[model samples]
Target: MSDTTSTTADRKLTEGTALPTQPCSVVWSDGRAFVLEPPVWVGLDHRGRLARLTPAALQRQGWSHDKLS
Candidate 1:
């Protein structure tokens, strides 16, 4: 028998799931738009804009951010 417990890196986000990354929205939560770079963990409020975030905070949050060219 093998115990296949998934690691944080293996976790996927969906309904009822708490996403490690920020969610997308059409409106700005803080009524402002900001550019997000990799290595930053961001959270969005009711609006689409970035509500809160920490730079290079993904490591502590058990997540990794990658930038695609």
Candidate 2:
């Protein structure tokens, strides 16, 4: 038996490492809605809305953002 890990490029997108080009709708904690573009990271709350986020900001808020697939 051989033990090997397969590396696939397609999995990168689902891994939340890639940025999207199109605009995405996001909702803030106060029920405010907004749109964000690429290079900006965002996360969804329990209501399934895009919330503004950044690597540094998220770390402070203890929240994790996922890329739109």
Which candidate number has the best TM-score? 2
- Error (Å) of candidate 2 at residue 63 is 5.3
Q: Model-by-model lDDT, in order?
A: 0.31, 0.37
lDDT per residue (tens digit) for residues 2-62 in model 1: 1122223322212233334344421111222323443343455445555444533322332
Q: Candidate 2, residues 1-69: lDDT per residue as tens digits?
A: 111111122233234443334668342222222335555645565477556665344333322132222
Q: Could you tell me the TM-score of candidate 1? A: 0.24
Relative to the true structure, candidate 1 has a C-alpha RMSD (angstroms) of 12.4
**Candidate 2 stretches greater than 4 Å from native:** 1-38, 63-69
The pairs that clash in candidate 2 are none
lDDT of 2 at 60: 37
TM-score of each: 0.24, 0.29
* Range of the 10 consecutive residues with the lowest summed lDDT in candidate 2: 1-10
